[model samples]
Target: MRGILAGWDSLDPALRWLMRINLIALTTATLLLASAYLLGFRHTSVEIDLGVMAVSIVLMLVTPPLCRRYGAPAAIVGLTLSALIFAVGGTWATPNLSPLTALLTMVPLLVGFAYLGRRWIQVLSVVAVAGSAGVAALAEWRRTEAVSEEWWINAVVIAASLPAGVAVVVLLVRSAYARLQGQSDELVESRRRVVEVADAARRSLERDLHDGAQQRLLASSVTIERARKELRAGRHDSAAALLDQLAADNREIVTELRELARGIYPPLLTERGLVAALQSTARRSAVPVTLDVADVERTDPQVEAAAYFCILEALTNAAKHSGAAEVHVTLRGRPHLSFTVCDDGRGFDRGAVDAGGLLGMEARVAAAGGRLTLDTGPGRGTVVRGEFAP
Candidate 1:
């Protein structure tokens, strides 16, 4: 079964549909033939109907290979034309065949419209319409008292209803395919933005290491070496002073290193939770900040990290760039973990910050399956809002 399915998948999609329809037609024809033989309708040109069914099956059986050679449009046209011929021949052969059987013509019409070119669709559709009409007219002309006066009415209903139903199905398929494509595009864009943000964060980390920790460590090493030389020269007084200076320099280097590490991933976020981490960030902000934090509640670690970083970045942007006197930070724990940071500062255009500091914040939020929105304009206060899934 798996092998068969793999083989089927190898065929063009249009050819697959054509093949499936043909198989179903063959099955139905077999059933009808058996029923006719058993019901004493053997005198109604049953051999002719059997021959038509065999020919349809043969056409269907060869369609996949033909589609591969001639393309899907030609294959669909073949199947459609075969279906029309089957309906016409069967109607002529079996007086018991219902005029409503003409409705089957719509199946191929729909297939042509959905998968074939407009020119082919137009041609096939015309043929289907003409064939259905011909079947109804022939039935009406040959009718006697044995046939109901409303046989032609059934034919009209079949002709009208099948096309409408097929049209609806075609419309629905197109709509679903379009929606899938739109989502695929969005996912691609989101992935690209995430990569850009990640690269920016790496550059920022590298810059911090070079300018802060590396420079400070170099200075501290120089001081320590100078103090060692003084001690070796037996200059106790100068050596003591140099030692104290070295201690201070080393302490400064340690402090700078701590700050750099915190910037990467703060320890406060893990040890004290998002509220304490955010409060620590607020306290360090150059601008004054007010916090409306909810009670500490355990949540997904990734979500907590995203919210904390979002608020932190907003506060940093507000203090350094917004020229704001004060900032407000709000955290909510219910429904979904969320936070908002607003600053009363000179705001900048959101679109203008494409690869700016806010991108790191946006990336963090996106990684957590959250949304980050920035509302800002020149001279207007900026609002940074982030929400996460529960």
Candidate 2:
């Protein structure tokens, strides 16, 4: 059942139409053969009736491919014409069987028309039921004396079968519509996530270029100018001090650039996985920090990385701006992996600091399919929490 559903879901709209048409044709042919047997074809010669059944089966089998190539409606019209020919022949030759055979013939038309929509389906269903009633009434009128057993039996079968067929076709149409809706929703969510990730990557690159490389170049130019002025004034000691300061500045630039690069894209994330990466970040932080990681083995890589960065950014902000004495980092990897960074510091209003570090952190977390929450106020400690799916 799953495999059949999967195959139906994967089919293109055009192919699905063809499949529906073919199934209708096959079912119609089966109904014709059953009607022939029920009407006692033994009264006629075996050779002649066998030839007629063979022709009907051949016509039904050949119609689907031609209909698929030309047009569905055109093909359906052709099938209806062929069934009408059979209906006329059965009514004249085997009079008692005509109503049941004609009613069965309407099944393909009703099922095929349902693909158009509810309005068309209703129109087709009404037409089919009315036409079947008209044919049964005509047959009843021909035998004016009394209702025969075969006529009553055929009438009961036609009444039960028509409604059951209609109900099954209605359910199939609803199922197809629901499946299409689900696929559309999935496509929308996938596109949204892709855009978020792309935007985050672009912003990270811009920030790194501005804060890391650009700052270093500006600092280098300043140091060179200072050294030149000191040398022109014949102050050897001052020039030497300026040169030493330039060398220290160069080292700082190199260190900061490496850190920025790693933050943008970390090799350890791909290698050691998320737990070790978070541990490494905690070890390198400036403040005295306590780290806790639980259920590390089950967490997804993307979720782990997002949680790690959220904590790293929170710790950096706490150390630099909050005047924090101690910071605690906690991570739990379960149904979802969650990270929390708490600090004992003079906390600032989260609303006031919306654009810079906090906003950037929020964007990063969101891009990773996660959320970041901040808890901070005047004179109180700050807590940063992030959660992501595994």
Candidate 3:
């Protein structure tokens, strides 16, 4: 049943819906035919009615294929009318037992015609009910049957059923459409948030470069210029001391620049991949970290990057804020990629720190079509986990 439902979901919308409607009609017809047989309605007309129902089941099975070969609208309309003919004919043949049974054919018609405008739906429904009644009335007269008052009851039942079915279809379709619209709106908002966060990150990078490394480099240039001036003025000792100070300043700037660059994107991540990069990060953490990374095939670069940052942030948080004695980092590769960072520490309330590193990690994971979960308690350990698809 699960496999069948999966296969049905994989079908094109038009074909799927057509087949569904056909299936429903087929089941209803079969049950009605069985009921007539059990009631001992063994006349030739009843046999003919059963034959019509059997043909309807075949027509229902064939309609989906027809919808694929011919256009959906033409195939659906033709199939609907064909099924209606069988239903009306069968009702006419076995009026004593099949009046309400004929009305079941309209179930598929209501579903199939839902995409057509309301005006067309109303017109077609009236036509179908009228045609069925006329056929049943003609069949009654030809058999020299009396004009039973029950004809009024059958007409009223069918009339009410048709409009009610249309109303239900309209309501279901509209509700589905509204749900889809809401999902679309949410996706748009998520995308906008990602873009905003990315732009903010870019600006932060620029600001850091200007304030930290760029300014230091400019000062180093001035110091070099002073050293050259002292050397030209024949102050050898002064020039030598100035050059020594310049060397120290240069070293300091290089270290600061490296730190800044690592904050943006670790060089090891690009050079050696996620495992080596994460191992380097664990080694650098203030708290001891044990890493368990599965040796498997590499994932997509984007997925690897997102996972790397998520673990990196979690480790940094655990080391800095959690005051943990030790951290455990686990990375799984293959099938689906996932990682977890856990620390046994004085955990803080999740609501209190939901914005900073946690929010960024959540955004990154969401961008990769993944999810991030954080578990923490006041005194218990904190666990940060993320799962992703490559």
* Tens digit of per-residue lDDT, candidate 1, span 1-390: 333323333343444644564566455655656565565544334556567667766666565555433455545666776676667655665433534346656667755554566777788778778877887765555455322345543343233223433443455456547646965875787788778877888998899889987887888788778888988999889989988987887888788888888878999899978888887887887999999976448777898888887787778778778899999988877534678888899888766765466766776787786778888899999998887643
Tens-place lDDT per residue, model 3, 85-104, is 66565556545434444454
> What TM-score should be assigned to candidate 3?
0.52
Best by TM-score: 1
Candidate 1, residue 341: CA error in Å? 0.5
Local lDDT at 365 for model 1: 86
- For model 2, state the Cα shift of residue 255 in Å: 0.9
On lDDT, who's better, 1 or 3?
1
Clashing pairs in 3: none
Give the range of the ten consecutive residues with the poorest summed lDDT in model 2: 3-12
CA RMSD of all predictions: 17.7, 16.8, 11.8
Candidate 1: give its CA RMSD in angstroms: 17.7
Q: Compute the lDDT of residue 82 as modeled in candidate 3.
A: 57
Worst 10-residue lDDT window for candidate 3 reads 156-165
Error of 1 at 29 (Å): 43
Off by over 4 Å in 2: 1-212, 218-246, 355-363
**Tens digit of lDDT per residue, candidate 2, span 1-390?**
233323332223533554454445435544654565567633332222334445544555554445333334434444454444444333333346554445655754554552344554565566567656655665555455323335544443334233433443455566557657865775575566556656766887898889877888898899899899999999989999989988988888888878887787677877888777777777888888898877656355666666666777788888898899899888775434678899999999766764456665666676676667888898998999886532
Candidate 1 accuracy as lDDT: 0.67
